[model samples]
Target: MKLKTLASALIVSGIMSQTVAAAELEISVQNLTHGNQFTPILIAAHDGDSHLFQAGEMATPALQKMAEGGDIADLAAAVTGAGGVTSENPAGGLLFPGAHVDSIMLDTLTMTHLSVTAMLLPTNDAFVGLDAWEIPTEAGTYTLNLNAYDAGTEANDEIINGGGAAGTPGIPAAPGMDGGANGTGVMDGSSNDKVHIHPGVLGDTDPNGGASDLDSRIHRWLNPVARITVVVK
Candidate 1:
């Protein structure tokens, strides 16, 4: 009886060891914007083929929802359905300017790449994104900077009217409390219909009635709107 019990114990220990052998990943996301805020962020560990967003490509329905409405449920669901590990909304809510958020440890033994995306507040269909990045097999720390991309799904009217739905014509909110009111709107038309880099907000000194509701000096940002660091162990 003692020998039989020992054999069973050994079998259980072996099974546990195998489960623990899976790869462990640590991901950190930092908002580099001086005035913008990031909506719920979506981090996924997927295969090389998976991409959260691609430049010059048509934005998916999920991507549109996220970029326009600050919603990440659809994207997270899509990633989860693809046999990928996901950390949804690690920040719990809006990540303010110059803030950082860390996700839970993701065990990605099978998934080999990582992707992340979040909407830039006070803008029309603009988002900070990182497409599929090959996670190094060798354990180490890696850093990357991300750029802001225009969803090209909306016309960027720059009118802050609480419009946070897909196909909306104006910005939803300016969480930084630096926005103006009753502006004339940025442009009357949009020339680009494909995803591309954001041209930055155009604001005039007149806040009560101007071409933009945002302050150009406070809201404008260059490329690489976010910084990401990944540690694999």
Candidate 2:
């Protein structure tokens, strides 16, 4: 499918989860960016038909809560309600630059696909994610690189004013402590309001009064923001 069309079709594509044999999974996640921070990670072994957030589709209220405020309560509930297995917040808190978590393990029942998500802090609605990755039956370590995605539920206002609630217009935070303050917003808002690949952050050098409150030297990141390793046992 074409990329643009896929965005709008995300809701219907792969909407069914295929069940897999019961297997134990050992998962590890690494933040590859130099300046970004990941909120509590939500890892799941789920049927292939369901998703935390589907690209090219509107963000669910549960997903909006996670993407906007770093809260996973509703999404987790939805996943659990769908009979998916979950591992919540293995990092315990924000996973900062170069940080990693290797202690997560899951014993799958009917779950076959793996989905992972976490809000990328200091942005309005940016997140690093893995959407419905199939778990290999053979037991060996598998590596995957994840991308930064926009929930497309909010504008990229680039202001740091602690507005994390869904539909709020500013970034909840800049955990790096190197971000600037009292600056004007960079972009007005996104044209696309569905889930889609993120246009990376556009921070400027002027901290006190730049177009963005984020520092260009510290807050910018390219694609493939995270590296994930999965071990099937």
Best-fitting candidate, measured by TM-score?
2
Flag clash pairs in model 2.
7-56, 15-49, 16-48, 16-49, 17-47, 17-48, 17-49, 18-48
Clashes of 1: 0
lDDT of 2 by residue, 121-152 (tens): 88989999899988898989999999999999
Model 1 Cα RMSD, Å? 6.6
TM-score, structure 2 vs. true:
0.90
Tens digits of per-residue lDDT for model 1, 23-140: 6888889999888999999989887788878888889989999999899999999998998889889999999999998755788867878888999998989999988988887889
How many clashes (backbone N, Cα, C below 3 Å) per candidate? 0, 8
Alpha carbon lDDT of each predicted model: 0.87, 0.88
RMSD of each: 6.6, 9.0
State the weakest 10-residue window (summed lDDT) of model 1: 15-24
The lDDT of model 1 is: 0.87
Which 10 consecutive positions of candidate 2 have the poorest summed lDDT? 11-20
